[model samples]
Target: MEKQKELVFITVIGQDRKGVVASISGYLYRKDVNIVDINQRIMTDGYFVMSMAVDAKAATVSMTEMSRELDQVGRELGMQVQIQHENVFRMMHRI
Candidate 1:
């Protein structure tokens, strides 16, 4: 049987700027995290918002470690980044 994927949702929000996607994706690539899907857009107010579905089962670091490192990356980019397990994200969004 195939191994189950450990999916997580990563959300980034902040002022629009260059290199945001490159920076985030580069970090993930270096960490061995696979991005399954991604969506990003600029809001009317000019804020940048991005959401990514990533498979972290093969990642070299734990989710907590990834979160901490991403937090630092966010700070450097002047943005806010958050990562949540897919199930937890779904649960929190459920009515």
Candidate 2:
């Protein structure tokens, strides 16, 4: 049987700006994280919001390290970035 993919959820929120997607995606690419799906938009208030589903089975680092590094990237972009396991995210958002 095939190994199951380790799914992760990534969320980004902040002011609208260039390079946010590029920078994040580039970093994931380098880390061997595959972005399975992504959705982003600029809200009426001009804030940028993005959510991504990623497969981290091939990632070079652990989730804790990835979160720390992504946090640094978010700080540089004046944004808040968060990562969580899919199950945890779902549980947190469940109605």
Candidate 3:
């Protein structure tokens, strides 16, 4: 049987700054959350927004814990970050 991917969607929003992606990606990497897809851009006024799809099947922490930790990391980076299960995100974001 093929291994299933337990996916999570992560969103980050804040003023553009150095190391925003590095800090979050590093944290996830250390926790073994594999990033499946990433999209990020800076608005005309220098605000940054990012969305990522992560494979969390092998992560060391649960989704809730990961959210909390990501929040902390965002605070450290001076950003706002949120995470949700892929199903939940897809449901809410569906057109």
Candidate 4:
């Protein structure tokens, strides 16, 4: 039997810069959060946007803690980072 994976969608938006993916991916790796999917791009205005779906069931850190830490990371990168449960994300984006 397999436990259902807990997933969260993480989104980051801000000015384009170096190490954005590296830093976030590194942190998630260390926390045992598995990134299931990721999409990123630089808009015409030069702003960066990254969105990732992660399996967090095996994570050593709680979602609240991850959110706080990610918020700090976003501050350092001058970006806005947001995390939400997969179900919630789907609901919000649904037609």
Q: Assess each prediction's global lDDT (C-alpha) against the native.
A: 0.93, 0.92, 0.89, 0.92
lDDT of 3 by residue, 1-95 (tens): 75698788899999878888799999999999999999999888887999899999888998888989999999998889988778886678896
lDDT per residue, candidate 4, 1-95, as tens digits?
Answer: 77699889999999888998998999999999999999999888887899999999889999999999999988988999999898986788886
Give the CA lDDT, 0 to 100, for residue 14 in model 4. 95
**What is the TM-score of each predicted model, taking all chains together?**
0.88, 0.88, 0.86, 0.88
Please give the TM-score that candidate 1 achieves against the real structure.
Answer: 0.88
User: What would you estimate as the lDDT of candidate 4?
Assistant: 0.92
Residue pairs with backbone atoms closer than 3 Å in model 1 (clashes): none
**Which whole-number lDDT from 0 to 100 does residue 26 have in model 2?**
94
Clashing residue pairs, candidate 3? none
Question: Model 1 off-target regions past 4 Å?
Answer: 1-3, 92-95
Best by lDDT: 1
List, residue by residue over 1-95, the lDDT tens digit for candidate 2.
76599889899999888999999999999999999999999888887899999999989988999999999999999999989889986788896
* Model 4 worst lDDT run, 10 consecutive residues: 86-95
